[model samples]
Target: MRSPRRQPVAGAATRTGPPVPPAWMRWLPVCYVAVVLILEPLTPVDWPVSFLLVALPLVTAFAHGPLVVAGATALAVVLEGVLAGTPCCAGRSVGYLWDRHYVADYVCTVLVGGLGTILAAHRIHRERTLADVRFVADIAQRVLLRPLPRRIGNLRLESFYLSATAEARIGGDLYEAVPTAFGVRLLIGDVRGKGLLAVETAAAVLGAFREAAHEEPDLAALARRMEQSVSRRAAHIGGSETGERFVTAVFAEIPADGRVVRVVNCGHPPPLLVRPDEVRELDSGRSGPPLNLGMLLTEAHHIDSYPFRPGEQLLLYTDGVTETRDANGVFYPLARRLRSWGPLEPRTLLDRLHHDLLDYSGDRLQDDTAALAACLLDGGPRSVDDSSEP
Candidate 1:
């Protein structure tokens, strides 16, 4: 049921920087100068079209740096002097160059140009600071929520994560998949809150899952380990929010044969299982408490198994996906959308979902969003040995 890994398409949601400005924006100041030059000759002498050149430095500052703006300022001053000294339209004389009004105009242009230069410098500083912040955030994302492999053993995987904050690359959402001797174990969860504290809690849960997924043999034991890890982490981060801090998670296991998938739902949204005929939510019959709250409950965590045959896809997501609201406050119809679409590759399916979600929410998500898609391909080892490596 497992298949070999395939190469992913290029330019697949890998951007982690600020958007680039349009090429045309850089020429705006030059175009303005050209227009001013052309109108100067056609207008009457009293019109003084060269006065418009005072705005040149401000226009350049919109896209250029301080150095370029300074150059633009100098250019505007020189052009103004040239227009004043030249005898162009009727009733205009060269004496206009030394006119008191022209003298005042020169001082005004220089003052505005200085302001533009300062503006450009400040803009550049802010941009560099933003770039540095994004770089640090990207590194944190790699360490916390690393990108998932395109293919792992028999499972073809694709993942998507979107932080509600434009400058942040990661947030409270976290996920990881490890192919161990037991099978391909998957973990996806969301911390209770936002900010640095939430990020620290997410890191603790992911660190525990990465380690426990390899060592633990039983799926229930893995869940227990995660719960203990979160509890310990909460203790270490003791504060008023310690009791409020928790994580909703789903742990999944797909064997080498890929015939069935076992899942443990811990106060998280149920994953969707998409088949050629229909789509359904893989809801566990009994729900378990979220991580860090196991001590309060005596009931044991339950593992539910579902038929995960080849050609079927499994989608795990956070509440942000289902809870996204449109202009009318209508929630995104995730299940309905999946049912309407035809059979699609795992990557394509997620790509479509990402765009649809953004469109539904008008590109304004209220919380962090994360999704992981796995497709069981046909043709692989039916039974993997206990010592087998993925």
Candidate 2:
């Protein structure tokens, strides 16, 4: 089935069409060599300068692509013959335009440039192959772990995820959402480490939650499954000390009724609950340990719930959002910063947050960060395609 179209998230932008071959392709350095080799002996009218004509096609090929390269070479040959002279062919011997030197120079230009065009085409193919690989990897990542829904049921969802390094894609930060029997369950968390491994832990938590959310009636059981999944996976890698390897997270469910919400905070930042009347931070009340913290064996066993009303929204995220620091080494004022934008679509909220972060750091982010916001409403999602990426 075909997927619905989506709008580009605020900050993400991509260039269209093929990559440039190379600027020098418009004229080969070898064309420069041809001029020196042929110019000195030309019958002033012969103008070995015809050879220089080859450079335009060759350079254009490099600056553009194979088709451009071929046409450029052909145009160069015609221009060289007209401006300079043509070969002294027997058929046109009576004309000065048919001089032997002019013919030889024009012929040589085509031969040299034709070879350059062939080679430039190969280079273009190689570049396209590399680009294809990168594109496939990007598409696969988006599929395996689809982005958090822009709108889950009646709530408007918006998010931002940035890796620790500019080159990175996935990171230790993770979030997930799915419509379940109870409601639209959403989660946001941060692993202890960074990079691919953190993503693995995140996947494990999400996988468990997906299955448990629908099966378990009690919220604590759902939280336990997440804890168990992370713990079990960590043991397979790290062993006994894994308890200290925790994931700070906030989990919540937006019910079908659209009038209420419940949450379980596990050593994560308390989500800020925003309503038309007022904006307030929601505490964990009685908290559970973060998912991977194996404290479950001997520690407590329950998760907390909350009151989520319509026209209200919830913002859940890792410490990266609040912990961002600025020029004087001062931390970013998240609450005050968010106050700058009163209420907005989730995608816009995330876009502005990402922009604020980049601006705060002067065009670069220092640490990995992730944020997810959802607005409660009395209606179903506006439209599926509009809610996600295009």
Please name the candidate that would achieve the greatest TM-score relative to the true structure.
Answer: 1
> How would you encode candidate 2's per-residue C-alpha lDDT over 1-390 as one tens digit per residue?
322222222233333345653546445645654563465344453334445665565555556666766776677667665554333422333434456776776777778678778877788887778667656545544643466666655667776676655445566777777777677778888888766677777777767777887887766677777877787888887865666667887778776764667888887888887666566777746677787764554655545556776666788878887777777788888777677678766667777778777768664456678888887766554422234432
TM-score of each model, paired residue for residue? 0.90, 0.67
lDDT of each: 0.83, 0.67
List per-candidate RMSD values in Å. 5.6, 7.9
Q: Where does model 1 exceed 4 Å of error?
A: 1-20, 42-44, 382-390
List residue ranges in candidate 2 displaced over 4 A: 1-62, 70-119, 147-153, 160-169, 238-246, 257-260, 284-288, 296-298, 327-329, 379-390
lDDT of 2: 0.67
With a 3 Å backbone cut-off (N, CA, C), the pairs that clash in candidate 1 are: 1-380
Looking at candidate 2, the ten consecutive residues that score lowest on lDDT are 1-10
